[model samples]
Target: MPVLRPLPTQGAGRLADRYGRVATDLRLSLTDRCNLRCTYCMPAEGLDWMPSAQLLSDEEVVRLVRVGVERLGITTVRLTGGEPLLRRNLEGLVAALAGLEPRPVLALTTNGIGLAGRAEGLAAAGLDRINISLDTLEDDTFARLTRRRRLADVLAGVRAARSAGLNPVKINTVLMRGVNDHEAVSLLEWAMAEGVQLRFIEQMPLDAQHAWQRQTMVAAAEIWARLDARHPLVEDPADALARGSAPAELFRVAGTTHTVGIIAAVSKPFCGSCDRVRLTADGQIRTCLFSRSETDLRSALRSGVEDAELAGIWIAAITGKQAGHGIDDPSFLQPDRPMSAIGG
Candidate 1:
């Protein structure tokens, strides 16, 4: 297992891995429960839910965030969920995290069905960024993919998010071959018109049933080809790599202020450049999305592990970090947990 050094002071500095990659961003999953059942993400019916007792309480989550920011130098914290907004007292959690001494950059990723009602409250709670997952522009396609007929609600949440000053709100679209690949540019166009940014992610092998196949993924090259034909894309002039280990490679439309991004996760893995770590809702630490194993932190937390010891466990998870996610390797294995269970 990966092991990390303890904080020098209360909130002193950077934490690096065995390969010298410093982890500065943390993705924290609040719950494994979600309202929608996206075909690519989870099952449609009779999904197994994590027992309430397994989930991190608001206090435990806040304490972990304290250690992350105060000790591990985690400057960014993105709250995720099967659908984060589904978690009650979410604003309270946001407020607690934002109130940390060295306040981290707090953001959220949600399906947006519940956002219209809570965007303002969350922003007021100090959420600086927001990303909404909207796969297709067509209402029918949205229903078919997510098995939820609530696209209008998601769209309204987008408007509410923008109005609430979640500047440059992002829309995450998972591109799939023969499914929504044909609508890549249209999604971009729609985002531009909606006054939000667009990020297209090539589908990966994080589904619940191990149903994913390499041939089924919509490669970033194809999405880029289609988008370039429509809007003429050029690499962002401002340093792309300088933005730390963000997965998206940004692009600018030829003559417009509008921008688009492609997270070529599978076709172009950024594992070598990955600088983020994950803390699952049930309190397991995963070094990478496709990590073969997880270190159980909830057990240690309940066992009365000290803050420094908990922080050490956090660092240990990094020691096992592979150079890459190994999607190209002949022996690569999809994570046993689906995106919903893993944190999306």
Candidate 2:
């Protein structure tokens, strides 16, 4: 690979769309392959996997990260996937990303099926933190929801990640009305006991069949009320730093500094403050998670495009970003791709 000319100071280049929201975070999907098929994330069978040759190489991912950091002023990155750990040589990619100049903060969103064995290597390779997707605490619920028998493995992975010093390990749970909503308080209590930060996400319309209905969503207000009824919640305003641009709204448990977060993406739209963009495993760049269109960077990259050209393609995608993802609108049309295809 040829070397590209370096840009000026890191924070000097601020990337913003027409809406004036600065883009400081990027989500890079490593692959679309995952071990488990979550009911809300993917169809049980016949998931179309992208040809391996079409996926970006480790060097390619690093180069884009460099362009993003140097040219677009992205300071934070999260590696997401159908399951990021399924990709071969992920630790190498982590190390490469960690070596960048003005190195951006790095993290991963994983299913945690095999994370128990990999946590130490990833932490040592300079990963900043991780968010594990674990919906219910029951093994029976796990099998029914995911159609898999890996609940024990995931729980073990969480313990291993904490033991490996993954600070404030976050567990992402999606609350489906009748599915996992009943466990809201139990999940919070579990997080408190285990010392892992817990975040409850409202189910979005990103499922495979477009079967997601508004009636299924458990509102953030309800989640809080349920938990508060059991254990009173007094807002802790001290976690102000984790508020802006972050999807999660943070609050401390009553009387103590322990925190709980609610990422109300649907009920409370935060598009105006959205600071993130996504790159699919197959190399399509999406400005919003609910975006109907994507810019094909893989085609451009394979054509041997220059750094400026690559940066321009990315900028064009961000420039066309809509004011907000119109999920609440009755006229909203779901994206053709599922969460797995869209990158976690």
Candidate 3:
């Protein structure tokens, strides 16, 4: 594991409160546009795209990231969106982030439509890693899930990413019960063969258009049991940084050295170690992916607040971070914003 140098205590201490968690991983949505509309992520009626004017400028995003790194101990920056690669000049942003002092580890999450063409450029421009969303291996099922008949394109993108040397390229698959659940083992087989780390995610309740039933959720333990029956498994050492921020629990296959991960966010909520913060393309700061609340950072940035002053606003926001999202509550309403709008 790489050692993360402790950030300067002056500005960093301002963000720490009752929760020992300091905002280290910043997920920034570059755009709300996507080429494919997955059934679980967007409304069947389509999405209302945010206006270009409302989106934060690339320079503004860079400035905010600098402040985040300086004051919030943000060391890893993940570029996300309806599909981050959809944004123009994405490489420019990657370059800017790469030039940051201490140079945060920059990564991206994409639907993999445009990545085939841009993967090399992005890697050359300093993107350290990538996570591609792939729901099913069956072409027809993928088409049904994404409402796009371009499964070949997505697969090409994945291969392109691997060729570009994106370390440990992660494939995120949402394990929808009765839908792609039957393909779980096959997906793992494909991942092991391709040298990609496969992550099976429990269907989250954030999809506004989909009627999420708790009964449809495949718990982590159940998935483990099924997978272990075919191939004995062992847990990997717990990753402190990714513990709660990410939903995945990692495991290594007994015979093969390849690893698999399961993200049971709904069945097993890892909220105690949550240390991530999300910034929408429009500049709203979201403390949690399932959060209904947001702080308007666009107004603050446009108001010409200095970095230090803006840092204070971020500190205040982190201080009020909820311990965990109560997704099981009957009152738990899907966020008005979709995953595309929320940056994955």
Candidate 4:
């Protein structure tokens, strides 16, 4: 166990880092367990998940989020998971987070397996928006991409989210080189028709197998070329600028109000304006998605530290946030934990 760093007695404002970026968006992982074994994320057999005892209980999660929102300056809270729907009491958890004194804009990133049954309840429980992962539209391709044949379930979940008024039902699609790369335009067409936002994310180096290669990963330029050839996308500079710290670069679907986004994490590198921080399911603070070090808070929380002290620790952690994810550096090393363990 690493020793806890000394807390700063002052600076009780936002979660600002050394690079002058203030983090207001918090991505908290409810569980490090997922139903699918996506080829880009983890092995088909899945990973050795964290023990239930090591996982944060519902009460602990609520307390930490409350400290973040009330004490720190977290305005947006996105609940993530190996698959958040696996967390049995997710609706109740959403309700608790929603009931905070200064309620956050609660959102969820899910695989959408069992979401059809619970979308309405989640919406009622104060979930503001949702981002579902749908890499391919073809069932066979989806099965090959994500070692499961539940593409229909994901589609159902997307529709359910829309029906339940989860506005801006964003779809997060990771385009691999030869696999599912051809579906980029088709996916966008589906998203536009479904009245949802679509974002094509550049595949990063977070896969469990460590098999990712720059040559093999689909580039942002290639994605744009494919889409532009079909729909003629125009840069929505105003909308992109308005998003502020959002990673996605917004573009208008030429001559239409509908828009599409591309998160060129590897190609464009948005580290200069990153405003997000991640909290692992086991109560560790990850300043960056590719951070190798994690500050343990579960121990401090269980040790009965005051909320202020916890806030101090959180601030200290962010103070050491990296300038970039460092995927391009010669010294860049993939974190030991894969996306499944680290949370999307």
lDDT top scorer: 4
How accurate locally is residue 270 in candidate 1, as Cα lDDT from 0 to 100? 76
The lDDT of model 1 is 0.86
Over the stretch 1-344, how does candidate 2's per-residue lDDT look in tens digits? Answer: 12223233223245667766779899999998889988887778849898999899888899888999988898999999989999899998999899998899999999899999999999999899999999999888899899998999999999989988988899999988877789999999999999999998888999887889887689989999998898787666656665788888887788766788898888888887789999998889999999999999989988999988899888878777887888867899999888887885
| Model 3 stretches astray by more than 4 angstroms | 1-14, 237-246
| Better candidate by lDDT, 1 or 4 | 4
TM per candidate: 0.95, 0.95, 0.93, 0.96
| Candidate 1 RMSD to the real structure | 3.6
- Candidate 3 residue 163 C-alpha distance from true site, Å: 0.9
Candidate 2 residue runs with Cα over 4 Å from true position = 1-13, 240-242
Question: What is the per-residue lDDT of model 3 for residues 132-183, given as tens digits with 9 covering 90 to 100?
Answer: 9998999999888988898999899999999999979999988877788888
lDDT of 1 at 235: 87
Itemize residue pairs with steric clashes in candidate 3. Answer: none
lDDT of 4 by residue, 242-318 (tens): 97878888889998888889989998888888889999999999999999999999999999999999998999999
Worst 10 residues of 2 by lDDT: 1-10
